[model samples]
Target: MKNIYTLFICLFLASFTNAQDKFLTKNGTITFFSKSPMENIEAENNQVLSIVATKTGQMAISILMKSFMFEKALMQEHFNENYVESDTYPKATFKGRILSFDKITATESATKVKGELTIHGKTKEIVIEAQAKRTDDAIVMSGSFFIDLADFGIEIPSVVKNNIAKKIEVSFNFDHKPYKK
Candidate 1:
C-alpha cells in the first residue's frame, strides 16, 4: 500500500513537470511604437511564433520581418529596404531563457524574465517584467518593454533622425498551449 501511494505521488508530480515543460502559441502578437515630434509610427506582427521550454530553460521566438505592417507605405518600404534590410535579414529571433526558474511559483501571476534578445544578428541582454497566467488549457505570457534602435544596429538617416524616437516601446501578448512533444 505504501509503495502504491508513493507511485501515485510521483505520477502527480511528473504530470505537473510535463505541463510546465513546453508552451505553444497560435495567436501571438508583437507590437512596437516609435514616437516623434513630427510623426508617430506604429507597427505590429500578428503571426509570431514563440516557444518556451521550462525543462531546458530554452526559449525561441521568431517573427517575419515582412509581417510588420505600417500605416504609411513609404515608411514601411524604407524600413524594409534600408533600416531593417528585410530582404536579407528576413526574420528576427531570440534564443534565451528565464534566468531563475526554480524561484518561480507555478501559480504565480507575475514573474521577472531575464533573457537575451537577438535582432539584426546582434544579441542584447534584456530583463522583462512579465506576467504568466495559467488558464484551463493554456498559459498566457505578456510583457512590455523598450529597446534602443542603435543597440540592434538599426540606423536612422540623419535627415529623419529627429523624426524617429531613439527608443521604441515593444509589447508582447502570447497565448501559449502546451507542447506535446
Candidate 2:
C-alpha cells in the first residue's frame, strides 16, 4: 500500500508542512468478525494505511477490501467476489476528526470521533468511540464498532444467509509516528 501512503501524505502535505503536525502509520491493523449460528467468520488486515493531522485532530484511514486474510480460502474468495465485490469497490475509507482534540495527551481517555465511513460504494456518517493517547513522538487509537450489512447495500444470498451475521463487528488499532522528510 505504498501508493496509499504516498497519496495520503500528499493530501496532508498539501495542507500543512510541520512534521510534528502530522503522524503516519503504514502498518495499522484492522479486523472484522461475523458471528453466526452455523459459522463464525473472522479476518485481519495488517496493511491498513492511516494519517493523523495533530494540529486539527483530523484522521483518515484506508483499507483494501482484498487485503483481509480469512482462515479459509473459499471464504476469502466469496467475500471478495460476492459480498464486497472488491474488484468493483476496492477500498474502504474513513475521514473524521476527534471531538476533544485539545484533551488528548499521554494518558488515554475515552473519546468520540465523527466522520464519514465508506464501504462497498456506500458512505455513512458515523460516530465511533475510541481510546486515544497522544505523546510527543506517537499517537495511538483503538476502537470497535458494529456495522449493519444493509446500510452498505451488501446483500447476502439466501442460501448462505444463516452462515453470516447481519451485523459485523469491526475493530481497529493505529499507532502513528511523527512524520519526517
Candidate 3:
C-alpha cells in the first residue's frame, strides 16, 4: 500500500514536469503610445514576464511600471511619479485566455484575446484582437489595446493635459518557450 501511494505521488509530480503543454518567457516587450496635438508620447519596456498554458489557452503577463523607458528622461520621471504613481503601484498585470488556442499553429492566426488588465491599482476587462504564431520551439503572441487613463485611476495634471492623450494605446509582444523543470 505504501509503495502504491509513493507511485501515485511520483506520477503526479512527473505530470507537472512535462513542459510541452506550457510556455513561459521572462523578457517580453510592452509598448505604450499616447498621441496628442501637443506631443506624442512613446515608451517601451522589455522586462515583461509572461506565461501561457497551451492546452488551456490561459495566459498571464506582468510588467514593472518603473521599467518603461521613454526617449526623454523628464518624460520617464513624470510617467512614473505623476502619471502612473509607480511608487504606489509598482507593477501592471493582465490575466486572460486566448480565444482560439487550438487554431494556433506554426502559421500566424488572428484571434480575440479577452482578459482583465490591472494598472494603477485598478482592474478592467478588455478584449483585443491578436496575432499568434506557434512553432515547435516557441509561441509568439502580439496584440494592441486601448485604455482610458481614468479607467485605471490614473490622472493627468490639468496643466499638461494637452500633452497626453486621454486614451492610450498599449501593445505587447511575447515569445514564450516551453517551461522546464
Candidate 4:
C-alpha cells in the first residue's frame, strides 16, 4: 500500500515538472500602417489573444478580423467586407516556434523569432526581430515587421495603387501571463 502511494506521488510530481509553460493575453494589440503617396492609412485591433507554450517551443496568436478599427468607419467596413472578407475568414493565426529557443535567456533583450504566419487563409514563413523582457509576472514581447499585401492575396485597386506602399508594417505589443495547467 505504501509503495502504491509513493508511486502516485512521484507520477504527479513528474507530470507537473513536464508541463508546458503558457502565457495568455486578450488585451494585446496588433497594428498595421500603410503609406501611400495619396494618404497614409493605419488600423489596429486591441482584442488579440496570444499564447506561448514554452516547453514545446510553440506559440500561437489569434486576432478577430472585425476587431480591426480604422479612423474612418467606411474604411473599416470596407476592410472587413471587401478586403479581408472577415465574415468568411474571421481570424488570423500563427502557430510556430522560436527557432533558437535554447539561445534565449530570461533577460531584457531583443531576439529574432522566426515562424509561419497565416493571414487571409494563407500561410507564409516570416522572421521577426522581437524585443522581449521578463516583467514581474509576465513576459512582454514587442516587434515590428513588414508584409507585402500581394503575398497574402490582398488585391489593391489600380486607382489607389500609388497611394499605398507595397510593404505594410505590422507591430505587436503583447503582455503574457503564465498559464498553469
- Tens-place lDDT per residue, model 2, 1-181, is 6686688668866787687698889889999999999999999999998888888988888898999999999999999999999999999999989898789989999999999999999999999999999998889999999999999999999999999999999999999999887
Give candidate 1's whole-model lDDT.
Answer: 0.75
Query: Weakest 10 consecutive residues, lDDT, candidate 3?
Result: 4-13
lDDT string, candidate 1, 88-135, tens digits? 887777666655554544475666677678777778988888777655
Pairs in steric clash, model 3:
none
Best by TM-score: 2
Instruction: State how far residue 93 of model 1 sits from its true place (Å).
Output: 1.2
The 10-residue segment with the lowest total lDDT in model 2: 1-10
Residue 88, model 1, lDDT: 81
Model 4 C-alpha lDDT per residue in residues 1-181, reported as the tens digit of each score: 3353344334433433443356667679999999877888899999887766566556677777888989999889878987778888777877667555545566868777778888788889988888886544777789999999888888878876897788999999998887555
In candidate 1, list every pair of residues with a backbone clash. none
Instruction: Tell me the whole-model lDDT of each prediction, alpha carbons only.
Output: 0.75, 0.92, 0.85, 0.76
**Which is the winner by TM-score between candidate 3 and candidate 4?**
3
Sorted by TM-score (best first), the order is 2, 3, 4, 1
Reference-based TM-score, model 1 = 0.80
Q: Which stretches of candidate 4 lie over 4 Å from their true place?
A: 1-20, 102-106
Q: What would the per-residue lDDT of candidate 3 be over residues 9-128, giving only the tens digit for each residue?
A: 344335444567778787899999999999899999988878787777888777889999999999999999998999899888887889988888898989888999999999999998
